[model samples]
Every structure is written in C-alpha cells, then in structure tokens.
Target: MTERQHTDQALIARIDPAALLERTRSWSAINSGTHNLHGLTHMAALLADAFAVLPGELSLVDGDAAESVGADGAITRLEHGRHLRLVVRPDAPVQMLFTGHMDTVYPVDHPFQTLAWRDANTLNGPGVADMKGGLSVLLEALRIIEAAGTPSLGYEVLINSDEETGSFSSARLIAEAACGKCAALTYEPALADGTLAGARGGTGNFSVVVRGRAAHAGRNPQDGRNAIVAASDVALRLFEARSPALAVNPARIDGGGPNNVVPDTAVLRVNFRPGDTGEIERARTLIGATTRAVAERHDVSVEVHGGFNRPPKPIDAGAARLFALVKDAGSAMSLDVAWRDTGGVCDGNNIAAAGVPVVDTMGVRGGAIHSTDEYLLVDSLAERAALSALTMSRIAEGALS
Candidate 1:
C-alpha cells in the first residue's frame, strides 16, 4: 500500500463512533437555544471542557450585545451566550479556520427537548444533526490529526452561541478569526445523502416601526393616521419587490389595539434573500424606497432597523479549489462528495465575505434540520471525521496551491 493509504487507514481507525454519539446526545439534551442564556452558558462550559483536550489556548469570549425592535416598537438590547475560541500554532504558515454553533432553533420552552433513536442507525433530536453531532465530528477529526503527531497546519476553532437566529453577536469574531487563513470549514449538517452546500444566497432581516397619532375610533378617527394600515402597505410593497434574484418575506406585524381606538404603532418584521451582490444592493434600495413612500402616503413616521448581516457567497476560484480538495479526499475513502447551490445562509456566507474560501457543510450527514424531525445518520460520525482529517492532512502536505 502507498504511504498515504496507510496513513488514512490509521486515522480512520482511531475514530470511535460510540463515543461520538454519546457526546452528541449529552450536548443535545441541554436546551442551548439562541435566547436561552442559562442553557447556553452551561453548554458553553461543557464544550470548553470537551475541546480542552486539544493543544491550544482556549477561552470563552464574551458575546457582543445585539439590538432588536420589540413588539411595542421599542428597540432593546439582547445579551447572547459567550463564544468559545481556540487558537493553535498561530505562527504557522498554513492557517485555517473551523467554526460551529452551539445554538439550535428549538427554544428552551419548545417541546422538542429530548433525543431518541429513530432506528438502529438514525438518531433524532433537536440540535443533534443541526450541530451537536457536527461538533463531535470536528473534535474527533482534530484528535486523530493530533495523535498522528504534530500537525504541519495551524487552525482556529470557533464554537459560537448565536447562529440559528443569525450570527450577529459572533460575526465580527468570525471575521477576525478568518483573517489570514488559507481556508475554512463550518460544521452545519450536510444533507442525509451527503450533499454539501455550494454557493449560498444572502439573507437580511428588518423591523420597520411605524408611529401615528392615536384617536378614539368613534370620534376624531380621521384626525389620526392608521399605523397598522401603513405597516401593512409597507409589507405588501416589500413583498411586491420580490424578483428572480431577490425573495422578500414579510413575516409578522406586531401592533393593533382594542376597538374604539385607532392603534398608533405597528412593527413589521421582514426577511430578504438575495442571489448575488447586485441583488443585495437592489434589496437595500427597495427597502429604502418602499419605507419612504409608505411614510409619505400614510402620513406616518417610519423607522427601519437591521441590514444584511450575511453577504452573498458565490464560488470564487479559491472556494472552487477548496471544494476540489475535499472531493479528492472523499474519493480516497470511497465516499462521493457532491454539492449544489442552496438558498439557506449560514456563517459560511459571513466567512466568505471576509475573503476566505470555506467548505461550510463539513459535518454529519443529516436531514430535516430547523425542525423537531431533525436526525443524524449515526454512521456518519466516524465517516465524516475521517474525511475531514484526510482533507486537512492533504492541505498540510501542500496539496493545494
């Protein structure tokens, strides 16, 4: 056998599937929802302890405060859980970034809070596939590489607490860690059939708050401007802005009052997805024009909060090279690694915005993410870990130019 084949066999043998599953189960049991501070703190501590086995400087970095417009048309500060960062061999020539999130879409009060085996090889639960399993895979891969002796590559591992809701708090930190890296890998679950995400569309969220004079419904009603009507108009105009390259979703409007009173406030929550950089600019322009026109037509004051946090990630030359490297590594292990464009956005978009090429779905093979039906293909734990280990080793050996 060739030297590379022998090395691959040794690394694959060291990954224990049972251990990886157990770690995922234990982490999934905790309700580390994006807004569950207590749960997030507890989960963060456990992750730090688990990742401490690696050779690096590990620290829980405080999260930045995020602002959200409330139902009452008030902007409030939101506190997020701390992010875990580990840097090893910072001075090494070939540096890379690996990131995953600890948060799941299931809130603390959500009913999907436990795990069960759907079958002999399928385990289902919240966050199990969407990322606790991915975390386990990442750690196991790193462990195998370390056991092989000192690695020639340097990498930074970032496990942040806010991703399901958007990586606002950890975005700056992600960009900072991505600086000067040769490539990046993010552990968002891959499709059950092992399909990865290729070029991804960008996403933006906005809350448009409208203010008007309040008046009694039975008397002087004409003296007051209807904020709810104005907000609804804004939503419709924004929805009409959708095109082949841009998708607009006006999700919720939070305002209205009892009869006999004209409601004076309304907040519209909307999301936008742009297919490319030009589309992103068009989306912004649409928002500005729509809000201004609505305000003028309805005679009400309008305020827009939020912008596109994730920029569109088109496959550049660097990203294409990284994907080719991953495909070659998967082929060596008899795995067919393929990808297609997805409308879903993740930290991958943010990292790519920093000019770093990233293969984001380097995690367990799973499906039904963002829902209670999420399941992880139990066998993929070791399978994907070995794939990652081999890929990183190839890069360390100067396989990519």
Candidate 2:
C-alpha cells in the first residue's frame, strides 16, 4: 500500500466501535425532547463534558425565545434549552462548520425511553438514529482528526437544542456560524441502506388565528359569525393550494365551545414544503389570498403567524464538489456512498441557504426516525466516523478547492 493509504488506515484504526456504542447508549438514555427543558439541560451538560476533549473554546449559548400562537389566539413565548458551541483554530485559512442536535421528537413522557438490541448488528431506542448516535459518531470523527494534527483546517461545532421543532431558537446562531465557512457537515442520520439525502426542499409552519363574533346558536344563529366554519374554509383552501412543487398539510385546528354557542376563536396549524423559492412565494400568496377571502366572507379577523424558516437546498457546484469528495472518501474505505433528493428539511437547509456547501447526512446509517422503532446499525458507528474523519482530512489537505 502507498504511504498515504497507510496513514489513512492508521487514523481509521483509532476509531473504537465499542466506545462509540457506549456513548450513544448513554446519550440516548437522556430524555432531551424539544420541549423537555430539564432533560435538554442535562443532555447539554453531558455533551459539553464529552466534547471538551477537543482543542477549542466551548460555551453554552442561550437560545432566543420562540413565539407560538395559542389556542385562544394569543401569542406566547416558548422557551428552549441552551445550545453548545465549540470553536477551534478560527484564524486558520480553511474553516468548516459541523452541526447536530440534542433534542429528539420523543418527549419525556414518551414510553419508548429505553434502548434495546434488535440483534447483534442493530440497536433501537429513542434518538438512536435521528441523531444521538450521529452525535457520537461526529465527536469521534473530530477527535480522530484532531489526533492527526492537521493544522490547515479549522472548524466550529454547533449542537443546538431545538432542531426537531424547526430550529426557531437557534436559527440566527446557525446562520452566523455558517457565514464565511468553506463547507458544513450535519449529522441527521443516513438511511438504513447507507444512502444520504440530496437536494432537500424547504419547509414552513404557520398558525392562522380566526376571530368572529360569538352569540347563542339557538337564539341568534344568523347574527353570530362562525369562527369554526371560517377556519375550516381556510384549511380547505390551503389544502387545495398543494401542487407538484408545493405540498401543503393543514395538521390541526384548535377552537370551538359548547354546542349552544357559536365559536368565537379558532387556530389552524399548517405546514408547507416548497421545492424551490418560487414555490415558497406561491405558498405565501395562497395563504394571503385564502385568509383574506375567508375573513371577508365570514366577517372575521384573520392573523397569520410563522414563516418559511428553511430554504430549499439545491446541489450547487460547491455542494456537488463536497459530495464528490465525501463519496471518494467513502470509496477509499471500500464503501459506496450515494444520495437522492428528499422532501425532508433540517439545519442543513438553513446552512446551505447561507451559501455554504454542506453534505448534511454524514451520520450513522439507520431507519424509522421520529418514531418509536428508530434503530441504528451498530457497525456504522466506526464506519461513518472513519468516513467523516477521512473526508475532513482530505479537505484539510486542500482536496476540495
């Protein structure tokens, strides 16, 4: 083997699968759900301790308070957990960003809180695949890279606490870190078969509040403006706005009172996935037009909250080069790396929107994320870590220019 191949093998050999699995198990045991403040605090502390092994300045950043429209049509502040940030060699010529999340979809009250061995090769549990395992792999890869003493590349690590809930609290932080970076890597978990997500569509979440005059249904039904009816009409109109480029889902509606009284308040919660910028514009136009017509016809006041936080991530030349570099690294390790377009959106979308080339799924191979059946391929712990280490090493060597 050539000297370079020998050096790569030596770095890969330092990755210990058993230690990675142990870390994943311990991290997943904590209930760091998006809304679980206490759990997230605990998880953040643990992460800070684990990531302290790296050579950098680490800090716990307080997230901005997020806003939410309540069922009573009142806007309220939603608190999120603190995020972990680590910066190393910031003055270096080549800088990169590495990001992951500590929060899972499963809340503290969720029953699937324990981990189990599906077999000798698979492990299942909360946040195992969708991304506690990914976080472990990321830390190991960075540790290996640091051990190799590559002085050409500097990187910043951002582990936010609110990614599963649209990253509202940490969006600005992500944008700041992504600025002026040559590339980014996000550990959102690859598919079970080791395939990564390519060009991802953008996502928006909206809450529409409808207010109407309430009156006794039996005594003055005609005099009362029905807010429930108006809300339903808005939902239908938004649903019809769905097209080939945009997917609209009106997830839920909250409002209504006793059967004897006309409802005075209703809130519609909807999500929109736009394939491109044009579709995002179309979605906004549809929302404005539909809400205006519904309000006029029902004599109600309409309010819209929320917006398209994640922009669509297309495969630009820079992104294509990053993917090719990753694929080549995987091939060097006798692994086949492939990606396909997906509708799912993550912090990667926000990072790519900042004009940074990012290959976001540099995590473990797993399936059934955001569900109770989520599992991680046990062997991928070392495999993916090695892949990321080699990829970063190549970037340090100026292979991505």
Query: lDDT for each of the candidates?
Result: 0.93, 0.94
Question: Please, what are the lDDT tens digits per residue for candidate 1 over residues 262-336?
Answer: 989999999999999998889889889998999999999999999999999999999999999999999989998
Q: What C-alpha root-mean-square deviation, in Å, does candidate 2 show against the real structure?
A: 0.9
- Top candidate by lDDT: 2
Q: What is the TM-score of each candidate against the true structure?
A: 0.98, 0.99
Candidate 1: residue 222 lDDT (0-100): 95
lDDT tens digits by residue: candidate 2, 1-401: 98769878988989988889999999999999999999999999999999999998999999788998998989989999999999999998889999999999998899999999999999999999889999999999999888988888899999999999999999999999998899999999999889999999999999999999899999999999999899999999999879989999999999998999999999999999999999999999999999999999999999999999999999999999999999998998999999999999999999999999999999999999988899999999999999999999888888877
Give the residue spans of candidate 1 off by over 4 A. none
lDDT of 2: 0.94
Clashes of 2: 0
